[model samples]
Target: MLSKRIISCLDVRNGKLAKSVKFVDTIDIGDPVVQAKKYYEEGLDELVFYDITASSDKRDIMLDVVSSVAEQVFIPFSVGGGLRTVEDCSRVLLAGAEKINVNSAAVRRPELIREAADAFGSQAVVLSMDVLRVEPRPGLENGYEIVIEGGRRRMGIDAIEWAKRGEELGAGELVINSIDADGTKEGYELTLTRMISEAVSIPIIASGGGGTPEHLYDVLTEGKADAALVASMLHYDEYSIDEIKDYLIGRGLKIRKA
Candidate 1:
């Protein structure tokens, strides 16, 4: 089996690292560059940097921060937030990110996904979906709906359908971030994770609610995720990348070691 990846996430607000629970009550943590460097030294497989407020705030991502983190981390770096057009994607790539994650903009104009994929290749494009669990309804399927702009707006699009569409539109990978489970750290939304992972052909990175190494194990196995994005567990010094990898390795999961 291919080695499962442990990814560290840096959610930036005004160039500062921040964390939120259920997509609300965000608090500034620390300098993202510092965290990025620390994670790189500790052996993280990949890093995802998101300018969390850029979309709703209607502004550009802090390229300076992106450059700073890029310089500090040698692993695969994925960036999202405030990327609207193919030109914007280019600017981010030129700034140093190995992958560009498109969320709100892509939902607003899915053609942007194809355009970005064509311009930078599908491997360079990642479609990030901010999803929430809602009551089952006629227009929505599986009780999972698409929420955007920091989970402030409900797009009314079905999560699974969107994931499939994103893959068909040429996204090389998908970051399925569960808003309800985000920062709770109890566990990943395994039912939702498994559903989307099975629906798509590309790799799925399970995000939100990862509090322990066991959570990572569950997501990669039962959830069928290719990678797990961790924030709160690592952000609060609750766990280290090496420690988590060791746990997964002991649990019989093939994990990339530091």
Candidate 2:
């Protein structure tokens, strides 16, 4: 079995690292470059840098920050936000991001996924989906809807269907973030994560609502996620990468030991 990966997420807004509860009530955490270096030193499997407000604000990603963080961290790093075209992906890659994550852009123009895969290879393309459970309307086939623009815009797209489509479009991985549970620490939305995981062949990185070491294990074991992405808990010093990895390993989950 492949060892489950524990990834640290840095949500960069206006060049600063920030965290929020349910995607609101934002609070500045620290500097992205410094934090990225710290996580790399602490032996994190991978680091995810997201320009959280770029899509909503309709601005490009912070290339300077990206370049700095990329220089500091030797592990794989994935960057996202405000990437609208192949050129945008090229710029991010040139900025030293090993992988480029696309959410709104891919949803708005799915062909961009193919374009990126063709230009940069599928392994360099990550499809990020911000999903929320909406009230079941009478005619809706799926219970969940995909929201874009930093979860500010509701597109009425089904989450499971979108994951399958992204995989078909040559997306190397799927980032399933549950907006309803984000930063709540209640645990991951296991049902929704399992749906997407089962629907897609590519690896799925489950994000949002990871409040404790047990929460991380729950998603990786019970939720059947290939990897787990966490922010708030780690940012606030609630847990360390080694601590979480130890806890998961103790619980019989296969994890990479640093």
Candidate 3:
């Protein structure tokens, strides 16, 4: 099997790293730059920096923060939140971000994905999906739907169809973030992750609800995810990147040495 990645996630709100449970009750954590440096030194595979309020606030991403974090981490990291146009994508990439993720904006205008891919290659564009389990639609293949704008609005878009469409629109990767599972820390929404993974040919990074090494294993293996995006587990200092990598390796999962 290919080596599964362990990506550290930093959700920035008001220029500080924060954590939220089910998209509410957010708590400030720390400076993202500091955390990024710490995780980089610990040998994290990659990092995902998100301006949590950028989309809802209707403003550009914190490019200064993105640049700071990029300077600290040598590993390829992705930046998301509030990125709309190809110009926005260019700005983030120029700020040292390896990949630009479009969530709400992409849902609103899918051509942005194609434009970004055409301007900066498919590998440089990421489709960051904020998904939630909803009432089953009669014609939909899955019970899940796509939610955007910091999980405050329901798009009524079928998650399965959206994933397929994202790939077709030139998104090189998909970050499947489960809103219901966010900050729960019990485990991931494995069924939801698996559903999207099976529907897309691109790599899928399972995000939200990662609290333990066992949870990571389940999502990466049984859930068929290409990578596991972790927030609470690493942010709270419950485990280090080395520890998570060691645990996964001990469990026979092919992981990059930390």
Candidate 4:
């Protein structure tokens, strides 16, 4: 089996690292560059830097911050938010991000995914979906709807269908971010994770609600996720990358050693 990945997430808003609950009530944590360097030195497998407010604020990502983090961390990383076109993807890749993730923009114009894949290869494009669980209704299969613009707007699109479409459009990977489970620290939305993982063959990185090593283990094994995207647990110093990796390794999950 391929080794499961543990990814550290840096959510930036207005040039500072921040964390939020259910995509609101964001609080600034610290400098992203410093944090990125710390994780890199600690031997994180990968990193994901999101310009949190870029989509909601309708502004481009802070390229300077992306460059700073990229320079500090040599491991492969991805950048997301406010990436609306192929030109934007070029700018981010030129700035040193190995992958470009599209959320709000991709939902608005899915061809952007094809365009990005064509220009930079599917491996360079990642489709990020912000999803929330709602009461089961007649038509909203799985009862999860896709939200965009930093979870400020609900697109009313079925989450599973969107994931399959994203893959068809050549997105090499998908980040299934569970808004309700985000920052809760209970665990990943396993049902949602498993459902999507079974639906798409492309690697899916389970994001949100990872609190303990067990949570990571469950997501990768029982939940069938390819990776776990951790934020609060790592951002708040609740655990280090090595600690998490050690636990996963101890639990029989393959992980890269520092």
Model 3 pairs in collision: none
Clashes of each: 0, 0, 0, 0
| Model 2 ranges off by over 4 Å | 53-61
lDDT of 1 by residue, 1-258 (tens): 689999988888888889877776889999989989999999999999888764444334468887877777788998888888998889888888999999999999999999999999999999999999999899895999999878999999999999999999999999999998887879999999999999999999999999999999999999999999999889899888889999999999888776
Which ten residues in a row are the worst by lDDT in model 4? Answer: 53-62
Candidate 2 — which pairs collide?
none
C-alpha TM-score for every candidate: 0.95, 0.94, 0.95, 0.95
Local distance difference test scores for all models: 0.90, 0.87, 0.88, 0.89
**What stretches of model 3 exceed 4 Å from their correct place?**
54-61
Shift in Å, residue 11, candidate 4: 1.0
What TM-score quantifies how close candidate 1 is to the native fold?
A: 0.95
Model 2, position 95: C-alpha lDDT score: 93
Cα-based RMSD of candidate 1 = 1.7
**lDDT digits (tens) for residues 1-258 of candidate 3:** 578999988888867888777776888988889988998888898999888764444344478888887776789998888788898889889999999989999999999999999999999999999998887867455899898877999988899899999999999999999998888898999999998899889999999999999999999999999999998888888998888999999999999985
RMSD in Å for all candidates:
1.7, 2.0, 1.8, 1.8
Q: Judge candidate 2 at residue 233 and give its lDDT.
A: 78
